[model samples]
Target: MSGIYIHIPFCKQACHYCDFHFSTSMGKKEAMVAALRKELLLRKDEFKGEVVETIYLGGGTPSVLELHEIRSIIDAVYADYKVAEAPEITLEANPDDLSTEKIKALSKSPVNRLSIGIQSFFEEDLKLMNRAHNASEAENCIREATAYFDNISIDLIYGVPDMTNERWKHNIDKALSFGVPHISSYALTVEPRTALANFIERGIVKNVDDEAAQAHFHLLVDTLQAAGFEHYELSNFGKPGYFSKNNTAYWQQKKYLGIGPSAHSFDGVRRAWNISNNPKYIKAIGSGELPMETETLSVTDRYNEYVMTGLRTIWGVSMERIASDFGERYRNYALRQAEKHVGENLLYFKGDVLLTTKKGKFLADGIAADLFMVNLS
Candidate 1:
């Protein structure tokens, strides 16, 4: 099965810590929507006849679009591709955008899932992040969304400066009380060139403490485990039968077509990404040219990617699958590299699956990199 990811590259405001491609300007919304629909029609054949099982409206706050505009894009997708019956359609919305009326409208549309960006439950944290919504809006939007969408996921961030352990736990409990089926919580990372980074560089804001971040990670694990939520991924937790199928497909390397500025697509061996500029993307697409770059994956690149993404999930790397797909030499190297972690009880080999222990989950990336074999031959 395949998926379609549509990036709505418009936001009402820019958050301080964001690096994702988005524009606060909404002047070109209509034209951009047209271009997106045209893009869907133009790239219809890229999926190679695989039924589209998921369609995700992500980025720049999809909720910013009007109901009609959102539906138009969904309709265009159906017109171009063989979308499966009852495909999982998701739209990523910011907390302030999801009013009761808006949630009701979305429920009537093709969107079956809502991924709300609540970030944090504290007004001070929201202010520090320069988020558009306040603490009340975050809680209210979840209530409104849960009233409409059953397959709802809310995004939260921990490890922000002054976010104590107790407050972080309260955030988790608040989400649980709201009846959200899925939760994707992340530790705050200060990406380079972002306002947060600048603030730290200038001493206006304290840098994020690695120790605080690690403590918050452990708090997430214990809190979610107690709530009966599956730690299916490094940053995701969900009740049984509520895991995100679109995101799961991504982790499992399922093919998807990303339609919008800064969007990336992958078939099995090759990956392509669209140009990040909105005006340039719309202009080129309007002129019937696909503005994107393509790259074919080398053996080492593919192995490293698999190790990186797979190790982040509950599904660990498979030594046997690696042997079959990547040849025996690479497989042997992986096993040998995995030995040190296994000895430390941070990794365990159960049958063909080499899984990371709970203690090692927080450092899965480091361990995965350690297991990586350089293709020097």
Candidate 2:
């Protein structure tokens, strides 16, 4: 099944650690929305033969848009493409933007899922990350949102500098208290040029400790698993029947069309991304130009990607499929590359599927890199 991802590249303010492309100004919000709708109409043929099973509104923070604006965008999708009868429509939101009135209004919209950006429920952490919402708003939004939406996911971040193990546990516990069916948690990494990185460079903030991050990840897994949450992905936990259909489709290498500035799209063979400049993207779309770049995936590229994404999820890499899809040469390369990690008990086999061990989940990315086929013919 195919999906559509709409990137809303506007936010109320910039977060210290975020490296995603977005603007703090809403000056072109109206023009951006128009561009997005037009871009959807312009790209309808891309998914002409495919049924859209998910429409994910991600961003700078989709909740910043008005209900009417959000509706107009969804309406645009319906007017052009053939969508599934009950598509999973998700909107990424921030706590401060999700007022009780807004939450009530959204329950009546086509959006069925809410991925709240409640990164931390502590004032100190919130201030450190420059999150728009305070600790109370974070707790309040989820408490109210759970009353309206059952298919809800909340984001949490661990490994913030000075975030003790106890504080991390409290964050997870606070999220569980809201009864959200899904939780996506990640260890904070300071990307270059972000405020967090600059802070570290100037010794304004302590550097992220890898050992502390690893400890937080283990604690998260144990606690969530005990509380009946499946560690479905390296950074996602969900109850049975509540995993994110959109994200799951992505991990399985399904095709998706990304609309709006700085969005990326993937067909079965090629990947494309829109330009990141907002005004430029708006002008290009208005002039009926896609303003995007495309690349056809080589066999090696596809194999490497599959290995990377597959290892990060519970659906480990399939040896037989690798052999059939990329030939035995590539399959043997993978097996040989995986041997060291397997010997270390970081990777093990379940029948023909190569999966990560509990001790290896936090290091999945690093281990997957070891299995990458860089020079295979």
Candidate 3:
């Protein structure tokens, strides 16, 4: 079974540290929704007679759209694609958009999961992140939504300049109190062109320290594991059976078709993505053309991608599979690299499954890069 992702490229406001493709303007909301529906129908044949096991409505803020708009997109997917009998449909929403009435409405919709953007449950942190919702809204929305949706996932950010360990612990504790089945947390990162980066460059805001972030990560892992949530992926923690099916499919390298501006898609080995422009995208789709770029994966590209994603999850890269798919030369290069790290205890082998140690999890991305064979074809 394959997956489908729909990107809603509009937001209510800009966050300080976000670099994802989005526009704060709502001028094109109606047109964009139409374009998205058209795009889904246009790409119906891409998945090649496969059933859609998961449908993810991600975005600039999918919550900004009206419930009818959201359902229209789901209806288009159902009308044009072969969806599973009971697909895991998810919608990424912000706290402010999830009013009591809206949550009740969503309960009747096809969305079975909610990935809410609750960056923090504190006023100061919310203000610092330039979040649209305040602390009250953050807490209230979760409390109300939990009554309606059993499968809920909320996002939390750590390593912000003033977020002390005590505060971070409190944040995690508050999230746990909600009985949320899944939590996806990440260290606060300042992208090159984001507002946070400019503030740091001008000494208006403090920079994120790697050591502090690492410490927070350790605390997060311990806290969640103690609560019976699995550290399934580097940045994800979930109770048993509550892991995100869509993201898991992605990390496992399953094929998915991304619909809408700035979305991405994968077809086993090839990769493609739409342009990060609203007007341009709308015009192209209207003209029966895809405003995007595609790349057929080279052998090295595929191998490196495997190493990158495998190391981040509970599933480790398989030595035998690598040898079969990428040949002995690439496998030998990986083993040689693995040999050095294994000695340092960064990565360990369970039979033939090469997995990362707890200490290696934070450095998994770097370690994966070290194992990449740049010269190999």
Report every candidate's CA lDDT.
0.90, 0.94, 0.94
List of clashing residue pairs for candidate 1: none
Report the C-alpha lDDT of model 1 over 287-372, residue by residue, as the tens digit. Answer: 99999999998888778778888888888889887878777888888888888999998888778888889888888989988977
Per-residue lDDT for 31-94 in model 2, tens only?
Answer: 9999999999999989988999999999989999999999999999999999999999999999
Q: What overall lDDT, based on C-alpha atoms, would model 1 receive against the true structure? A: 0.90
Give each model a TM-score: 0.98, 0.99, 0.99
**Arranged by lDDT, best first:** 2, 3, 1
lDDT tens digits, residue span 20-39, model 3 = 99999999999999999999
**What's model 2's TM-score?**
0.99
Model 1 clash count equals: 0
Instruction: Give candidate 1 misplaced runs (Cα > 4 Å).
Output: none
TM-score of candidate 3 to 2 decimals? 0.99
